[model samples]
Target chain A: MKFGVVTFPGSNCDYDAYAAVRHILKEEVEFLWHKSEDLKGCDVVVLPGGFSYGDYLRAGAIARFSPIMNRVIKFASAGGMVIGICNGFQVLTESGLLPGALIRNTHLRFSCKFVNLKVENNATPYTSACRRGEIIRIPIAHGEGNYYNFVGDIKALEDSGRVVFRYVNSRGEAAIEANPNGSINNIAGIINEEGNVLGMMPHPERAVEDILGSADGLKVFESIRAACASLLNTVGGK
Target chain B: MNNDSKKAVVYVRLKDGVLDPQGITIQKALVQMGYKDFLSVRSGRFFELEIKADSADIDRKVDEICSKLLANPVIEKFEVEKK
Candidate 1:
């Protein structure tokens, strides 16, 4: 499967996502410039982590207005799979592709470290490879990773089983201290109701290689690659 | 040519119940500096825009921009002032 990584002007993780797909996952991947309003006939689209547009106004706020975002939104509306990581998560929220908003970290500090994320639900295409309650070590580096939504919306997210990943400790417990950012309900990632779009604050692409510290993040990509292949086969597509 | 450009000042602040870590940090700093008699502190952002004079319906235009771009309605509220 082909993966298209959107590259906003200030995006620094484009190459990382590209390398993760090309080398680790052995998939076709290319950089989709922010100004290009095309998906390049890719199976999946990845909004890599970085301070897009220099995090102007707010994290991912300015980058949301990029010319390519229109096409991305259209693609998502058509049920295409899209993944947003770190600042990309912020952009997804800003673009209305995902629910809620990402605000400043509760500690008011740029958190840069590896955090444990437990798979809350393994039903979605992104996490189908992961078993429920399984923990993965991924590096999270962001200053505005705090997720917030209205109380009703939070309840709906839980009721609908859209919360895909939650911050947890080594024991896979969603303890308060384990939450790197003060995301509501310790959310590390979430998927939309349609399940085609995902937004997470951690950099899975950065952790897809053992040499980079951990290869646990590769499971997420592998899950998508395998799922997409099966989906194509079921639909009689190559 | 007349200077028909008008200014619209916008103030964006987090909604009530939403935690403001920056505001909390500032409050802590103030307390450490020996200041007292404070219920709480909140933080916000603002923007100044010079509207073109020929643009009609300034109020609606400003409100649209504020809600759609200047402030995230999910977490923050924005107030626009014509100047």
Candidate 2:
């Protein structure tokens, strides 16, 4: 499957995502500029992490108005696959493709460290390769990763199983200590109702290699590939 | 001489019940510095917009921008004041 990594002004992880897909995953991938409206027929779009638009007005706020996001929003609404990482996650929320908003960390500091995340629900296209309750170590770097939603909305998110991942400790338990950014219910990632889009604060592309400290993040890419291949096969059979 | 420029200020603030870590941190700092009477603090931001004085729909335009770009309605509420 072809992947398109969007490069907004100030996007630093666009290369990381491109490299992960092309060099590691060995998939066809290209960079999509913020000013271009073309997605280049990519099957999946990856909004890589970075301080887009210098985090002006608010993180991901200005970037949401970029010309490229219009296409991304339309593509996602049509059930296309999209994965947003870190600042990308912020953009997703700002674009209204996902619920909730990420606010300042409860501690009010930029936290940069490897944290364990438990698979909350593995049924979505993004986490299909993960086993429920399994813990994987991934690094998080941000000062405003504290995810928030209305209390009722959060309950709905949990009840609908749209919550895809949660912060967890070594034993796969969602504990307060493991909640690095003070996200409500320790939420680390979530998927849209259609399950076509996913937004997560952890940097999976940064953790795709064991040499980079952990290879656990590769499963996310593998899951997407598997899902796409099966989808292609089903269409071919018809 | 004709002056045609007008100014509008938009205040964006986090909704009540939403935790404001920065404000809380400032409150704590105040206590540490012996300003203990300051029990609570809230933080917000404002934007100044210059618009045409002759615009008939200035209010609507400012409100639209406040909702669309200046503030995230989900977590924030914005007030537009014309000056």
Candidate 3:
């Protein structure tokens, strides 16, 4: 199970993502530079969080045009697993790999804190480890974390089960107070139509270690590993 | 020159109901300065463009820029006014 984490020029969480997969999960991990056009032999490609390209011309705007994005698009199209976290989520939406868009926080301020997320759908490979409606805590830090889609489009996402994660409170209840960045419907994460590509604003890697105060995030990575292992076994059997 | 007569104003703003993180930051600063009268503030981009194309074609070209480069229609609203 070789996992690859893409590192853009200003990416700050590539190491964190690598450590979570390689050291914590004890899975084979590699660094894929933003300019690299190869994704051979990689089971999962991660777009880690960071202020890529200094976020100069809007978050993920310039990074989406990078040469490597072509490869990422190809990988996703072929049913490959791809996860984008935080700023990485911004990039996915910018590249049209994901639907909707991340906007400035409704409060118009950068928010950095642990947020409770409700697993809306666990049927996909990314959230198979999580039970539907289960609440998990993850840290989110970003200026543009608010997510929006047309009302009709949002309805479609909900109907299609693409609306995966929603912000919640400590008591496991959804409310305005728990809506950290004012994302519509409190959406913290979503998946593409194929369910192979996921983009979320929270940082699961940051919560993977118990020493960091929580190990809840490990379930996310573990789930992916399990899914990939099963996939490999299925291919071998065939 | 006659060609410079075509002008347009481009108004780019974040979609309604979406958060304006940068605008919120600025509002906070203004509040600290004792300007408590402001209920809310939203920041946006404005461009005054003069093109060489005639009115008939300029609208289409400007629309392309708005959808492709000037503004991301996903989270932004853009308005064009002839000048």
Which lDDT tens digits does candidate 1 get at residues A43-72? 899999988988988888888888888899
With a 3 Å backbone cut-off (N, CA, C), the pairs that clash in candidate 3 are A106-B19, A108-B20, A108-B21
Pick by DockQ: 1 or 2, better one: 2
Place model 3 in a CAPRI quality band.
Answer: medium
Per-model TM values vs. the true structure:
0.97, 0.98, 0.85
Residue by residue across A1-238, what tens digits does model 2's lDDT show? 7899999999999999999889899999999999999999898999999999999988999999999999999999998899999999999999999999999999988999999999989898888888988888889999999999999999999999988999998988889999998999999999998999999999999999999999889889989998888877877822
What lDDT tens digits, residue by residue, belong to model 3 across residues A67-101? 78889988899999999999999999988899898
Off by over 4 Å in 2: none
**Candidate No. with top DockQ:** 2
> What's the candidate order when arranged by decreasing DockQ?
2, 1, 3
DockQ for every prediction shown: 0.90, 0.93, 0.49
Calculate candidate 1's fnat.
Answer: 0.94
Worst 10 residues of 2 chain B by lDDT: B1-10
Q: How accurate is candidate 3 locally (lDDT)?
A: 0.88
1 or 3: which has the higher DockQ?
1
